[model samples]
Target: MTSDDAAQPCPMPNAHRRLMDCHAQWHRLHEVYFDPHEFRLTMNSLVQNLRNVTWLLQKQKAQLVGFDEWYLRFQQSSGSNEIMRWIVKSRNRITKEADLELLSELQVVWHQDWLQRTIGTSSKYPPRMSIREITNDVMRRYRPPFGTMTVRRRWVDKALPAWELLDATSEAYTRLEELLAEGHSAAAVPMCDLEAHDRECVTSSLRASGTRPHCMVDAKDDLEAHFDLVEGVEIESTSLVIERDEELIAKSVERYGSRAEIPTSGPIDAVPGFMANARQLMETDGEHGTFVFLYRGDALIKMGGLLFYNQNSKILAFEKLASQVKAMNADGVLVIAESWFARPTKKEEELGTVFFPARDRLDRMEALTVYAATRDGKTAGQISLVTRDASGRAICAEPDDMDDAVVNTLAPILRIWAEMDSSTN
Candidate 1:
């Protein structure tokens, strides 16, 4: 019989249900880790849920084959694991005397010029701020080198094992999941494999229905990468303007060879027409608003587009688009797009905004920033003043020189393009 068919005949359904509840509690705890009040509330719920799973399983031991032996082994093993022990103790403390104590520590690292420098470290509670808020605050207080920042806040407790609270909780949840899975095996009920499902949902906020799986924090890297892009404008603000001139072009050509070209000194009369065509294509083809154009010498060779999702997905989407560009074996790529971006602002922080909202506003000047890179590790960007009238008709102005941050952002794409070119030729 299939796992689902076997599960229908299983006698220890309540135990399985409790295990699912425990998983839900753990997931909720992870979702509100930043908010101290919500975190404490969820932690209590998680502890109780974990206890219920074992208690329910023990009560249904007779129905589950080999469950008594499994329980004995689980008790013996979990009693020895320090974090597991702490979890049991915390549950008792909550039931008898008071809430468990929690301490939060925040670490801020600034990545600039190929170096990771710790900008701030502190232990605090209650008024726990979100990462974006903390980052904006840091920018307001200190003028660090122009680069990205990663803010990590971990909750801990002296009463628990010397591990981050989340790490300890994850361990406890994993052990309980193992116990539940073992119980299912003993009852001859097929257990639904959840590892692959969890991986698929890693970057999403949506929770899985029915039996929830152990979620891996795979989005941590993606979130940090997104933060880099979100805070890039602030970092780039400090860059000294290198006017688009012969000197800059000469430097680019020296580094990347004859294929490297700077943004044209004069406005391209064809940009408006190109943008209009792109808009038409997007409207009719149901393609993404953003378009990538590959050029062989002065002729357009290939074109592709991707829908701009949230900031977290942007990095991967861009990488995918870049790979397509490299596959075309073209000399150059020009990207045209309009998207909202969150920028660091001291004013918002000063106004006592605890949470910096996602990108909500689109500036006209920032609307038409074009990123171009050649197959020889050469990159350039231009900001064209794109204005819309009351009827929403757009007027495109001559493109201006973009900052060094754009170049930094384009570095990976350029490197990949150059590598692909080398491999092909």
Candidate 2:
């Protein structure tokens, strides 16, 4: 028995030992296993080293596992269960109940994590590590205030999740050098006083330009970055108020008496084609508002700005806007001076009007909530322009609520036109 046991190498303690011997002697295969904590720690170490390359690594991970396949797995296991809820709640460091409640509401039941804050341990993950989910959570939290936020594809792998670890002594020394030199050069640029967005944009543009370093005025040495906020933005109103001539208004109303009024909608290609992008030429070529009368019917043809000034883009599109005014010459301005047509627009004609009765008119009722962007009168509201069918029952030309600006601006013009025209009818 002693001899047999000696030959058997004192018998392995467990299946693992036997497997290890078999792996070495018989199969010559290495039985590999990853230490969960150690592997995670190792990956976390790469965060500082590969800050720029983070996205690429995450993409590779996704590609190896197959995006669709791993996505399903991720969905199954991540940010779920009571433990996860506790983890999230425990992670958030915010102490105030209001702030905590806000965070809870923002994160949702599954993604809410408070473990890191509570445990006094939190690590920022790499690009692919835990970023996408967190980013998606943030996007979901913030409701779109303006049409500008069209947040669909904006977050598409834009920022890699990697924390840059700065060595205090070395970074401070390097920053001191950066602080001493003009920041225009990448070698010396200081990141201070510049907003985050502007700094990033300027840095990116400067890098892309590949221009040799030139003297920069008022360049700072140290880089300090923060998010940008608009300061004293000038918003010049695009609209204006114009005085109406009672005589001219009457004639316009008479010409528009509702005798089986016809719609203006037409085939998409009703007009003969010109240059495809003539909009610019018509908009900016002239001094101001442009108008034309159709000789065939002795009526106004399509009227556009004589000279359209694009304040935002700073591009002028004359001849594009159908301008005929100054410079080469002409000035960019409004010729008709904010005139709303007495009649409905060609689009309104196509959409057909719905009539509301006299009793339904809020003007007829007391304590009506007549909302206005800017009110003029004591009780500011619209005064409708009236027309009639064969029945002669009053039919005020109704404006749509969908276009508050257009309705508010055009209401007075229509009413003035109607009063002047009522005399002739």
Candidate 3:
């Protein structure tokens, strides 16, 4: 028995042993075939071996504890299941003159999903390794054996999956390095922030330098060496705020709207292709007095900013919004200012309105919560409450025992925006 076979103890040793042997014969079939006829022969043999293994498992179904989980090993994988199914269907129909166009399709799907190079513990095998030992070995060697003429074809096929893995792995390390350098604890850095920084740094670097490192081994080495630097750092949380009071909006309009070209400012609004993406941004309502407009733009594309619903009169309110949208049109997005619904403290008056840092915006989408109704020229608590996202999608709404007309006005607008589904709201 191999080291792996010895490690996993199976109750039915005879059945398990047969499965392992079947897996070995199937894997050896991956050897390169010099002739198309030889390739078809290998594929036929593999299909028959798979059929025998499947039949054996069905026969011993009661003996296995992880039959469902073990089967998932094949189903969860990208194209392995499809390849198996295709081969099974071609079994009786396959001839020595068989055209193996399906092999080309398999190459494309496998490369796209990076199913070839096994990495990480999670990617290694199923939890009950004994149950999957046979199938895993067979799948690893499913392809035809590489010959001198086929070597170049194999290299071209594997290049893309390798490059994609290298790029993603490198960017993850780069983000960790940036977060640690900024004196932020790894635990405190939200997942959204890590993803954002990874995309930004990789994109900027790629633009400046046409080439990137393709060595994952070196990348893994560097990550291990610096892992200690970020192990137990102190956590800190801070934010910069841009107040949405009257004076600031007037200045923003004059500054951004005056120029014929739009001014791109703030991380959210300065993303590439903002104009094209803005057309997709959705408007939504939120809890308390909060209103929002979520940019439906690509995650890589940035276009986020704040507008305020401070105007008391309905006519003036919409006019102010229209003006703000025109001024911020360069970024192509204008979310309602988060602070508009937040009660101001004495410290805020001194900060004024300009660019300021804040906690990751996406992370705090559901932070604000307040409920009030207008009565006797004063604001009072109301039982009914609602919350919505920038896309005008209602996140939550709780009806009171008795609904008041004044408070119910805060309900979400269900209008269908252009190019968006009418049922979305």
Candidate 4:
């Protein structure tokens, strides 16, 4: 062995001072037997191993403590594995201790936002976000950096191989995986236990009726159900330490002791801005005008309400409106017609030509927003549009085809906006 292979003591501190002194004793024993430099390198490797193991163990514990009601519910049910997939993708990506806290807070925020939208303020208690919405939000918020393989491809090429390597090299990683699987099973345990109890109750009831033969079958089924619940049950880890989330703050000390506080003061007041924009667009005659709002990430959230104008206006006006909408990050359009013409109106044809290009064309339109207009001068049959489906995909319906029923229902809405023209004046 070369002189450069001399053993250097592991310099990092430990909790116990006595343990730290053990290094000197070890070096004395190995002084004549082993290459000192190789021993130093091994010590470095052991220190790194300890750090990596500690990180994984701490992460597992935090996840357990941080598991909110929504996440627990997600673990219990079967559906799109989007959240699991996201969690898998996010594995090994978080660097600091604070990231776990951030993730927990984000989960709570996502759940609360969904509840407010779905059940509104009428709900007695805060509700969790649906799996689908939470998954989409995660996908939007924690998008992979540019040039990374897509999620599907990465799962096959990178994630799977990494897991295999982890299992082979690190006992800590394998233990973490086992703990996670056990937690999932634990989440599912309550439901299974409930089913088993119910079956056992039925079995007892049947036996009381003197139907021994049928009861035997039920009794066996009940036993099997009970066994299923117990088969993979694991003791919850006591060593896992949970980091406290700082974002949840006290709104009131009396009624609601604590609530998840959003970082912002409150939800954005978009209506007033949208109305101002709509008014400006309607009053202007020649200039191209648009008001854009991002609802999610960088994409425009879906909204309702149609702007109406006289049909005699130049085709360029419609073209300009379509162009402005298309330029923004929007997926679909809605067009409202005041009257049911037997065939497509000139404006509809023009909008269709601009908004919905042939599927094969080089500039083929991906999606278009719908528009509405009032043809009948009477207040009863004005154009209208509304936001009906909050959860559905945004659409790009062609204006050329107006549904008779839709026109009948939305026409009254156009009448309500008749005062808009006078207000503009």
lDDT of 4 at 89: 34
**lDDT of each residue in 1-425, candidate 4, tens digit only:** 11223322212112111121222222322231123344334333322342343334344444443345433543443133322333333333332221211100112111111012111111211123332344344445543322111111000113223221111122222222233334434444211111112222221011111111222221211110100111222111111011122332121222333233322211122222223333233323212222222122222333322232322111212222332232221222223222222233477577763332233345333222223233223111112222213654323222232243233222323322332333223
TM-score-superior candidate, 2 or 3? 3
Ranking by lDDT: 1, 3, 4, 2
Q: What TM-scores do the predictions have?
A: 0.45, 0.14, 0.22, 0.20
Where does model 4 exceed 4 Å of error? 1-79, 86-279, 290-425
lDDT of 4 at 116: 20
Best by TM-score: 1
Which lDDT tens digits does candidate 2 get at residues 1-425?
A: 22232222111112112212211221110011012244233222222222212223244443232434533443354244222222233223222221211100011111111111011112232222332354344345642322111111101100211111111111211221221121223223222221122122122112212111211101111111111112112222121122234565466446533222212321111111111112222222311132211111221222332232332211112111211111001111112221222344455467875243233444432111111221111111222233335754434333222233222222332333343334224
Ranking by TM-score: 1, 3, 4, 2
Comparison by lDDT, 1 against 3, better one:
1
In candidate 1, what are the lDDT values of residues 164-200, reduced to their tens digit? 6665666666677667667666666554432222323
* lDDT of prediction 4: 0.25
Best by lDDT: 1
Q: What ranges in model 2 sit over 4 Å off?
A: 1-151, 154-340, 344-425
Residue 181, model 4, lDDT: 33
